[model samples]
Every structure is written in structure tokens, then in C-alpha cells.
Target: MANVLPSFPNAAPTARILHFHDSIEYESRIMYSRPVAKALAHPGHTENLGLGVATARFAESKAPDLHLSPHRDNGDPCVRVSMLSAVLTNKALLNTANSSLKEHYPENFKTRNACPLDMGDLDRLGRWHTRTVFTLGTPDTASIYQREISRLVSLHPYLMHAVLAMTAMHDRFLQSSDLPNFAQSTAIECYHHGCAAALFNAKLSSQIDPLDRNALWATAVLLSSMALFFVESSDPEELWPLAPPSPSHLEWLNMNQGLRVIWDIAEPISPGGLFHDLAQNPQYSYFQSKMTSEPQPGIDGIPYYFTTLYDLTPLSNARNNPYHAAVRTLASLLDVECTPFTMVKFLSFPSLMRPQFKALLKGKDARAMLLLAYWYAKVCESQWWIKTRAILECTAICMYLERYHSGDLRLMQMLEFPKARCRLLRSGTSRA
Candidate 1:
């Protein structure tokens, strides 16, 4: 048997039916505001989908109104045109930047380079140049590119959408434009040229790869995003979810590999050494003759071009290998018998530091001072691992160095807790 309760005789009046209708209209307008079908029709719809997702994730707080209509509110067509131009131009610039880097530092670009614009050395140079040109309003293409990117990013939603749409429409536009072959070729060339121009201006041409030009541009965008992460106090975990884990083995490999290459070339020939014996032995010459004799080109050839120009070596062979020479180099630096302050400060000198750290650590020395410095600098610059690995590593190093020096108790205490706390008293009548 089922029991049913009767309605109360004295209940509040139901809300007006008009209110429900109004609510439905408001929801309908909001739903209509989103141009999902229109977005689907865009040529770069997939890329736009990614961009939209990223933008939604990144700029959610700032972008309250999601609906974007460039054609509405009497928007300037020129602004839309400019937005499209900027995206295409930027893409071209990125390609050019990579080509320039490949032309300059082919070996490092091929082996050690992470992404096209991931060259720390070149970033510093670009920053310096950006500062100089923007301050002076000079005709620096690097600065111009940077400025345009900034401007485009800051535009209204409609304009930004237009830019994104244009990025998708780029290939189609190229195909449709009835320009002469030379003009069309120039347009195509501009893509690579712009990238090269930017890289050259930043003194990063030597670190480029023709195959990785797009990756380089992506790297630049990533680095720029990383910079913004610091500037805006954004969570890196949210932005770069797949970022390398703490105590990055890959980074350690890169550090050691670079040192190993230096070691192989820099080490003097040992007296009565096997290498020397092999060079002099006539029997070894026969074996050398039996081996395939490919023409080894000098600086003018493909392989030698980047190495001779940049004095950079490949980093692939050093991965997972013992850095014995690197250890020796570090021991030499430490045996100089300088004060801890001097030693720490000396680690700042790149020529003395990288090799020294690699040598001392022997690929197992996780607490190497130079690695600590690198972690510290990256933390300061990008705040990438502030509360995670970087801080932990820095603290551990500080403690290790303190223990090693048998440091002053006061200094050690200061390092532990340097801040003073103040207690505030409440003003109130005393209870009996």
C-alpha cells in the first residue's frame, strides 16, 4: 500500500510564472552568444580549439564574456586585417629564427638544443636587445616582433579571435593570393626569414635547426609563457603539466655531456699513450685504410660549419656516461684552497664553473655547487620550482656548505630564521 501526503492549506504563494520565462530568455541569450558552429567553420579550428582551451584555462578570470564578434559594434576591418597579418607574420618570424639558429650552431642545435628558442645564452642577448630597442624606439626587428606580439595579445576578444582564425586560414590565404611566383615565394620565404631575423638579432642564430624551426617558435612561446608565470604569479604545474620531474635526469645529462665533450678535446695527449701509439703505428694505418674513407670536410663543409663558427660541440654521446674528466676539472677548482665565499662566488664564472661542477660531481654529485647555482638562477628568473625542487635543493646546499665550513653559529642561525616576529596586544577591559 502507498501513502500520499496532501498539500498544505496555508502555504506561501508560488513565484510568478513571468520570472521563469525571463530566466529562460536570459539562458537562451547566453547559449546563443556562443558561436560554436561559426568556430567550427574556421580553417584552423583544431588549433583554435587548443588555443580556446588554453585561453579559457589561462585567462578565465579576465575573460568574463566568452562571446566574441569582430563584425559586431562597427568594428574596424583594418583591425581584423592587422590581427591576421600579425599571426602569419609571427609564424614566419619563428621559422626564420630557427633557420638562423641552424645556420649558426648546427651541432649543438642538432644534439643539445631543447627547442628552437630554448637557448639560454641567446635569450639573455635577446632580452638585452629588446630593452635597448624598445627604450629608444629604434628600428630593431626583434623589438618590433616582440612589440607586435604584445599588442596583438592585448587586443579586444574579437580582434584576438580574428588573429586566431587567420592563423588557421594562413595556408588557404597563401593558395588563393594571385601574386607572382617571386612575390608568392617571398611570402613563403618571409616565414623563415622573420624567424632568422629574430634569432640573428638575439645572437641565437648559431643554435637553430632547420627541422626544428616550428619547435623553436613554440619554445619561444613556452619561454614567454614561463616568464609570464613568474610575472603573474601563476602556477607552473597548471601551465606546464608535463614539465620534467624534480632532480631532472635529463638536465643532469645535458650538463655532464657538455663537459665530456670539452674533456675529450681539451685533454692533452698522454705520454706513450695508446692514442699516440695508434697514430704512429704503420699496422694501424692498414686498418684505417681498410675502413671506409668518406671525405671529411673542414669548416666549409656541412658538419664542420656550426662547430667552427660557434665553438660548440654535440651533447648526445655524454648522456648516462661517467664524467671522469669533468670530476678532475672540479677537483682542480676546489684544490685552489679558496674560502667558501670565494668558491661560491667563483662558481658564478661560466668558464670556471660548468666544467668544475661536472668534474667534481662525476655525474653522481647531485649536490654540485654549479648545479645549485643553475637551479637558483632559474628559480629567481622564472620561479618554476620555488616551493618544490629548487627551494629544497638550495636549502640542502646551504646546509651542506655550512656543515663543510663549520660555519659560525650566528650565521647558521641567521640562515635558518632571519625574520623577526612581532606580537600585538589587544586593548580591552580585564575580566574579574
Candidate 2:
């Protein structure tokens, strides 16, 4: 008989982040239950991938109009959600293992220095990222981060572990959720060990070697990617209907700052010639022109954000002009009535913009930052974890702007909603 793994427990009731018309108040208890398929059971703690295919077939039989092709199945939101849940469970188990190791093996205090990452796990992770994660990068450029990570395999285990962990997390979405998974669990263990080892090495060494510097920088980037993947992969339907973005969402944003700090303190990758090539690409000009073709708002309507984005085109000649993309994307997001599927497609905003926009953010361009806050506000309107998370981020942005760009009239006008929202949040009136 196939063994049935426990289903995800009922998540605790969370504070309502959305507004409601509460003309009446009533007390009620709700119970939720889902049927578990015997065929989907994980026997002897092994993944039942056959079940995923079976489940897909079953779903197709019920709703043939979905046109559920095999290729399309890989991208199916439902399947992806199940896969993510399973991976997250595996990630939790890995955490428990590390905690147990620390309590039992005093000598192995740092997991990275003590535990050897399995070669098979590493290869699987690498292959997964090459097939999936790398494809998400800009169309013209060979993924700089991917190339850097691949080259560092022999030179930096810490970096490798981070990259492997991220890839493994992504790979989980490609597997069966109702099963015992090892690859993701092992990847998480490697990440824990690698992060501790790398941070310790970076801190203790007064003069950082180039390799060590690269390791730290790469770790930050990969860690951020991991966090974003977790946030992006989560589905509100299976999870909760109205929950804020997880802490991982904020952590990913913070890692961008960490990357900047790394750049300030130590030299990054030795030969970053590719950055120059990417920056000078002519495609950026085309993107800028396309953005410029869009109708501009009146100056009174905060046109500075769009104008500044236009001006930023010359700053990076070849790379995708993130400012233009962000502005244009925000316009689309505001104008469109987005569902979860459309929302996920727009979630690419952070992924597409982060790599290039880091420089602008480091420089503290007020208009650029304000536009970002606007983008997040648009995100807040979406029905996902990002909604509440984006609200918090918008509030934080308003606070930052108030501290630094208070005198700017356009910034003040742009931040009106964020300020009002922040005030409402602070008043404890928003959380139900």
C-alpha cells in the first residue's frame, strides 16, 4: 500500500490586509477539507511523479477546454503550486536537520565547513538552473550571473552552494509535490553551510582575496534570487487568500543593498567586461524610444518620473534600460485589470529590473526611487502576497523619501498614497 504523506496543515488565520464593507458583524467557524488521492501517495517516502502525470490527465479529462498540452503542463500554475509546497516542506526538514546537527555534533558548528555537498545534488541543481533560471534573463545578454556562477564551481564552494540552493528550489516546482524529496533538502543544507562559511570568511579576513570577494557577492545575488523565487512561486489559492508577502520578499530587496555594500568594500568579479558590453547594447535605445512613444502625463501629474527615465537611457548604452521598462511596465500594470496569471507575468518586474537598476539605486536618484515606490503601489493592488508586502515597501519608500527628498514637490505628490497608507497602517486600522 502507498504511504500517504500528511497534507499541509491549516495555516493560522491571519490579519486581513484588504478593505471590507463591514456593515454587519457575525461570528462563525469554518472548516476546510481536501480529498487526498491514493494514487498520489508517496510510498516508502519516495516521490510519486507518476501521480503528477496522472493528475494532469485527470484534470484534462474534466476540462479539455484548458488545452492542457504537456509543455503547458510544465507551466501550469496548479502543478507549480503543489511542487512549491513539497519543496518548502523539504526545506523545513533540512532546517531541522541543521538544528539537530548543531545540537549533536559540537565540532561541526558550521555546516558548510563540515558537511560535504553531494556531487549528484550539485549536478542536478546546475542542470536545472541552466534549463530554467537562465532562460529568465534578458534576451540579448548571456546571463552574467549564470556565467559567473558556472566558472566559480571549482574556485568557490560557498558561491556554488548558494547557486545550487536557488536552482534546487526552482527545480522543486518541476517535480511532484506529494512525495518525499531529497534534492531540495540537500540543496538547503548546502545553502546554510555555504552562507555561514562565506560570511565568516569575509568578516575575519582583513584583506579579502578576489575569490572570497566574488564568493560573498555571488552568495548575496543567489540568496536574493532564492528569496524572490519563493515569493513568486507561492499561490494565494492553496496558501491563503489574503496574506502579506513573506519576509523572504523583503530579504530579497535587502540583498540588493548588500550587493551594493559588497561593491563598496571589495572589488567584485575581476573581469566584468560583460557589464560594459551589456550596458552599451543598442536595444536599450529602442526600448527607450518605445517608452517615449507612450502618451506622457501633464507636468502636474508627476511627469518627472517618466522624463527622468528617458534621461537615464544614455547612462547604460547597451543594457536593457530598467528605468524605461519599469515606467512602461507600471503604466501597463495600472491600466490592466490583472488576475493571478497576469500578475505573475508582471512579477517579472523585479527580476528584469534588479540587475541593471542596482546602479541607479546606489546613486539615490529621487525620481527613480519614487517610480519604484509607484510600481510597488501598483503591486499592492494585485491579489497576492505581494499586495501587502508591496504596501509595506511603499511605506518604507515614503519614509526614505521624506528623510532625504522632502523638499522635492513632485516626490511629495507622488508619495501621497504611500503616506496615507502608512498612516492608516500605523493607526492599526488596516489589519482586520
Roughly what TM-score does model 1 have, to 2 decimal places? 0.25
Score residue 412 of candidate 2 by CA lDDT: 83
Looking at model 1, which ten-residue stretch has the lowest summed lDDT?
A: 418-427
TM-score of 2: 0.39
lDDT of 2 by residue, 1-432 (tens): 112211212211111100000100000000001112121122322332110001111111221122234465567788766556645544443344334333322232243233433323434443533553343334343266556444544345444445544555444544534211222333243333234333323332333443455545555445544433333222222221123433222334543333334433333322443233544556433322321223233222324555454554333232345466556556556555544335533554554454456456555566666766766665554432244445555666676678777897766876786577545543442211
TM-score of each: 0.25, 0.39
What is the lDDT for 254 in model 1? Answer: 36
lDDT of 2: 0.40
lDDT, model 2, position 198: 38
lDDT of 1 at 47: 25
Q: Ten-residue segment with the worst summed lDDT in candidate 2?
A: 23-32
User: Candidate 2, after superposition: displacement of residue 296 in Å?
Assistant: 14
Q: Each prediction's Cα lDDT score? A: 0.28, 0.40
